[model samples]
Target: MSDVSTRVDIALLGIRGGSTPVHRRSGAGPSDDGHVLIGGFGAALPIRSDSPYSLAGNKLLLDGADIGMEIEPIGRPKFYDLQTADGVSYEKIAKLHGSNVLATTVVQTCIRYGEDERCRFCSIEASLAAGSTIAVKRPDQLAEVAEAAVRLDGVTQLVMTTGTSAAKDRGARHLARCVRAVKAVVPQLPIQVQCEPPGDLATISELREAGADAIGIHVESLDDDVRRQWMPGKATVPMSEYRAAWAEAVRVFGRNQVSTYLLVGLGEDPDELASGAAELIDMGVYPFVVPFRPLGGTLAVDVDHASAPNRDVLEDVTRRVAKELQHAGMLGSDQRAGCAACGACSVLSSAGG
Candidate 1:
C-alpha cells in the first residue's frame, strides 16, 4: 500500500492539469497496462516554437525524469470506414469506447440537459453539438453499427446508454429495443445498458430479457448534498430509488454483473465514500470510482471545477473497497459486460481485481 501511495504521488506530480492547448496536446497516450494514463504530456519533448504538435523528437520520461511506463495511442477502429446501406456512417451510430467496447448514446438529447438540471460535470451534448452523431439512433441503425464493429474492429462487447427521456421508464424501453436489435445480429456479444432508475421496476427485467448481459444505474455520488449540487435534476429521484433500482438490477443481472459510477472528487468525505462503496459491495454491486476530469463544455468547466480527491484519496478509497470486494469474491472480471469489465478509466481494478 505504501508503495502504491508513492507511485500515485509521482504520477500526480507529473500531471500538468487543465485543458490548455499544450495540456490537451500532452493528453493521454496508451500505456502497456492496457489503459491510457489519464493525464500528463504523453512523452517529454522540448518546447520547440516551430513545431508545437511534434512530441516525437523528445525522450519519454516518467515521474518528471525517471523512465516509467511507455505511452502508445489507441488504434482507430476498422469500422470507421464502413457505412450502412442507408448511407449512415457506422461510426455515427456506435463508436469505440476505451479499446474494445462499442458504445452509443441511443438518444442524443436529455431531459435534464436544460440549463437548470444538467449534470455540472457532463458534456453529454457536446459530441452532439460538434455533429459527431445523429440526434436519435434507430434500432436498425444500432444493429447495423454493432454488426460492422464486431466483424471489422474485433469489438468484444457493447454498451448502450441514453439521455433521460421524458417517459417514466427513462428510455429503458428504447434501450431494450436497441439491445434486441443488436442481439439479432450478434447473438453472443455481451451488452451492457446504462440509465437512471426507471419509474417501473419491471424495466430492469425488460432489459435483461432483451439480451443485456449487464447494467449500470450510475449514482455518480452517494451523498445527497453532492448529488443535489452536481446533478440537481437526477438527484430529484432520491437515493432510496437508486437503492431499489440497484437491488432489482442485481436480482436480474446477478450480483457482480451490476455496477455504478462513484465519482470520488465530489466533496464527499473519504470515509463516507468508502462506507457507501462498501454498502454497494455488500449488495453485490461494483462501485466504479472514477476521477472527475472536467470534460470540455460542461457547466463544471465553466466554473473551473476540478476533481477534489487527489491520488491519495483515490488510492485510499480504492484499496479499502477493493479489499472488501476481494473478501466477497467479487472480482471485476466476474462482470459480463460494461465499464467495470473494461476496467480502464478506474485504478481500482489495478489495485486488486
Candidate 2:
C-alpha cells in the first residue's frame, strides 16, 4: 500500500465531490464549509460515498481496504450557536478552521471583486452573499467570538484574513486593530494575520506590533503569466511588491513565521511551482502548497471537477517542495499560528515538513 500521506493527497485531488458527505463544515465546498479532519490533518476533500474512498465505522476506507486511518467530520464549534450582544450569530462573526483555529475574514468585500479583476479561484464573498457571514466583522465582535471559541471550544490559535481594500494599507491597518482586540482578550493565544501587501511596507511592522505572532502574504502563483490570467486585479500589484512585503514580513515575523499559499491545479508548471517554493524557503517563507478545490460561485467552479490536477502531479510537486522545506529547516509546525500551523489544507506535514 502507498504511504498514508500520498494516498490522502491523491484522494483529495480526485475524489468525487458530488456524493453525500457524512459530515460538513464551512468555508467553501459541495457542502457548507467543505472541510473535514483526517488523522489530525484538515482537508476540504470531496465527500463521495460511492467513490473508492468513504468513511466507514470511523475509519477512512479506500477501495475496501482499511487505509489504517481514522477520519471524522469536525463538529461545529459551540461558539457557532451563540449570539453577540448586538445580536449577530457567533458564526457570522467568525468560524472555526480545521479543529482548533478560529478563522475569519476581517473584511469580506474586496476591491478586486469586479468581474475583470477577481481571482478566478476565490469566492471570499460567497459566504457573505449566502448570509453565512457579515461583510465586516467588528473588532469587539471578533474579540467576543475569539474568547468564546477558546473558552467553549478549546480553540488554540486564530487566523484573520481580509479581502483587499482600496486603502494604501491594503487592509493591514484594520487587521492590526482586530488583532489588538483579540489579543487584549486572549493574550496567550497565538494569532496569524493574512492580507495582500500594503502599499506602505511599514505597515508590516505595525501588524507585528499589534500582536500578530505570524503573517501570511499569499501569492497563489509566482508565475506572472499565470497571475495575470487568474488574478487580474491582484496581479497588478507586481511580484516586486510581493517580494518587498515578504522581506519586510520575514524581518518582523522571523524565519518560518511568515507563510504563503501556493495552489496547485491552476495551470502552473509543477516543476516551476516547486522551484518557486524553494525560493520562498530560502527567503524564510513557508510555501503552503494545496490542491485547488473549486468552491461554488467562483469563476473556476465550472472547471473544478475537470481541472483538479491528477494524483501524479499533486504528489510530485508536494514531495519536491517538502524536500526544499526540509533543507531550509522550515517546518509548518514551527509557524506557531496560521494556515501552515493548522495544515488541514495541505499534505506537507504528512510528508515530514
For every candidate structure, what is the RMSD over all alpha carbons to the true structure, in angstroms?
5.7, 2.6
TM-score of each: 0.85, 0.92
What does the lDDT read for residue 67 in candidate 1?
A: 41
Note the Cα lDDT for every prediction shown.
0.73, 0.80
lDDT of 2 by residue, 1-353 (tens): 55645455544643434332323333322233345666667755654433576666667666777778776667767888899877999988887777788888899899998878988877777777778889998899999999999999999999999998999998999999999999999999999999999999989999999999999999899999989988899999999999999999999899999999998878899889998899899999999987776555677775434355666787778888888888888989889899899887777777777
Count of residue pairs whose backbone atoms collide, per candidate: 1, 4
Q: Which ten residues in a row have the lowest lDDT in candidate 1?
A: 23-32
Q: For residues 198-303, what per-residue lDDT tens digits would candidate 1 score against the true structure?
A: 9999999999999999999998999999999989999999999999999999998999999999987778899999999999999999998766654436777677
